[model samples]
Target: MEIEVRDLAGLGEWSAASALYRSVFGYVEPEFGVSPRLLAALHENSGSVIGAFDRGELVGFCYGFTAVEDGVIYHYSQAAAVAARAQGAGVGRRLKFAQAEAARRTGARTMRWTFDPYALRNAHFNFAVLGATAIRFLPDYYDDGSSDRVLVSWDLSGHVPAPSRSDEVVAPSDGRWSAPDPPDRVTLRAALIERFRAGGRLVEVTRRGEQAVYKFREADR
Candidate 1:
């Protein structure tokens, strides 16, 4: 399928993107939904609202805004979602690269986002596919203890090296994609927290035999 990645324009496109976002994430609560008005405002205010279209249909989308911390300017990608049918077809990656290009045009050199630590697919995508590095482990990112996130930073202009084998590995005993059991979840969470606390940065997720393992290396000082 021919996929086109570009900036979304007009109310029609914005509304469609909003609907797809809610649908992909199954957001039932009003508070969890993204309004078209918010997206329009973000588009007007130097934020990117990019979409991947397949034959004029919105297949995937990503949105982010310019941010600054400690005098360093960067782009903060808040959310990205691909339609269920369009997943595994490189649409999400296309949306991200398009978003990064937009950010680069605004003079930003870094892009940051967060993902669930337990989602091994997301971890692999962020570290292995997109060359992002996990810099922080947020215990309760939403303030309601509903989610535990790993904050990742992606260099917009640099070519990051592929991850190498590391001595530190976090592997689940059960070989599950996620830690569903409370005990397993707690153990994995604590291990990741300790690694991040000691200046470790997650660089890769690899498979050793039948189990997936996360690899970390010391962050550059």
Candidate 2:
């Protein structure tokens, strides 16, 4: 599928934007802050938003609003959603690059957002792909019970110029694994989701607690 990024306010774009988010996030009505009018407002002031389309079908989008947090003004490049079908083929990466350019033009130097730490894919994007290092990890930033959030910060000055080799850093390990800590009941095989920002492999112990799941990261072959 072909992917192109466009200004968020373009005709029929908001409908497509909402649909993309719905497909990607699968959240109920209570969770969202977007409406056609709110999206229009986002287009008028502060930072910008963009959508990825394939053959005239909206497949993905990245949006952010301006905010002052911790006494710092930032254009928080909050969230991006891609059609589930378009994942793995680099749609999300392109959407982010487009937003980065858009944010840069608006004089935004840094971007901040929140994401679930358990999503290995996001870990690859924020750290390995975007060259964004975490300033902190919040245990229950969302307080939703499931999927704890981590507050993320990105510097436009240090953006990655090319698609990241996220594959190389986080390779799946052997099957039926366990963390060294026994009482933890969190049986986890090692999956290298990323490496240290300073340069080393970052391995994650996938499942933590009783009722353990199957092998999370096993040998590819």
Candidate 3:
């Protein structure tokens, strides 16, 4: 399926995007739907939103914005949706890759986003396949009372100076990730959680061939 992707406002595909979200998310009343005006505001800001079309049909989309933090500017993805039919064809993955590219073009050092925790599929995509990490787990962060999703922030611009996990897991680990044993010498998950609450944490999961990796450093207790 030939697809075209570009930065566009919510206006151009407002109707179709909404419909796609409703379809994929399976909402009877279309709750938490995005409006064209809201998307336009996001578009006018530092971040550029994108849409994907296949055969002249709106199949997927995403939207978010950039912010200044610790003297560095980065984009944070808010929401992304794809039609059910297009799920297996790599449309969502492509859209995410495109979003990361857009962030790099803007000179941002990172791109962050939140994902539902209970979504097993998302775990494979965000954590394993895409190599994202979870520095913190915010319990009921959304407080929406109806969803079990957690916030998963990612870094798009690997251009930033940071530690490298060059030899932990040996490649081809596409979503076939395994959670390593908790740190043997420490209980630092709380501190990590705190860092996330303060927005000072950005988790990076590296894949080495078929093996996935999660690496971190805490005060050696």
Candidate 4:
């Protein structure tokens, strides 16, 4: 498919972006859906909205707004979605790359977002492919009852060190499995959560058998 990805700069693209979001996330409730008006308002303010079109039909979109944490400004990617039929087609990655570039131009040094820590594919992509690191474990982070997530920060500043080696730090043992089925859902292991809260920074992840090993460094605090 000839995919064209560009800024969704006007209200004209909002409905299609919201429709794609609903289709991908399977949101049936109106309150849970993305509002074109809200999206348009975000673009009007200090935010961004990008859409991917396939033959003039919206296939995917990513949206986010500027945020400040610890006095550091960053872009908080609020939502990203691709139609079920268009997933695995490199659409999500492309959108993120574009987002990072756009964010840097706006003087942001990082982009923060969250995703299911139990989602192995997301882990691999966010950590291995995008070079982001998990900073916190947000249990029940949302109201929809599907809230378990790992808050991550992508280093748009391009100065963060490479992920430390897996063997350099203590690995959590709470949620180890004997190589379970691929792509199966699991919860955030309690031991890992403790490690994070105790000033640990996840620097590397490796898969052993059905077990996923995570490495962390003691926080400087």
User: lDDT values of the candidates?
Assistant: 0.87, 0.60, 0.62, 0.77
**lDDT value for model 2:** 0.60
Return the lDDT, model 2, position 145. Answer: 53
lDDT of 3 by residue, 1-221 (tens): 88887777546576666667667777786456766777777777767578788998888888778876778887888788888777788888888888888888778856777665333466668866776665456655668753333455566644333554322212223344232233410233344345445544334444555444434433112
Root-mean-square deviation of each candidate, in angstroms? 2.0, 8.6, 6.6, 4.0
* Best-fitting candidate, scored by TM-score: 1
List runs of model 2 lying over 4 Å from the truth.
30-33, 159-221
Tens-digit per-residue lDDT, 1-221, candidate 4: 77888889666789888888887888898988988998888787778788888898888899999899778889999889988878899988989988887788778999999987655677777888898888898877986676677888899877667444333322223243312433233433566677788877775666754467667765534
lDDT of 1 by residue, 123-200 (tens): 778888999989999999999876899999999988665555354655553444655678877887888899999888
Q: Cα deviation in Å at residue 111, candidate 3?
A: 1.0
1-221: candidate 2 lDDT, tens digit per residue:
87788887854788768766776778677556456566677888876678888888888888888878767677877678888788888988888777777777777777777765445556656666776544444555666654445555677887433433332222222223222243332222122122222232222323334222221222112
Q: Which ranges of candidate 4 are over 4 A from the true structure?
A: 162-188
**C-alpha RMSD in Å of predicted model 4 compared with the true structure:** 4.0
Those runs of model 3 whose alpha carbons end farther than 4 Å from true positions after fitting are 28-31, 146-149, 159-221
Top-scoring candidate (lDDT): 1
lDDT of 3: 0.62
Indicate the worst ten consecutive residues by lDDT in candidate 1.
167-176
> Each candidate's TM vs. the true structure?
0.93, 0.69, 0.68, 0.85
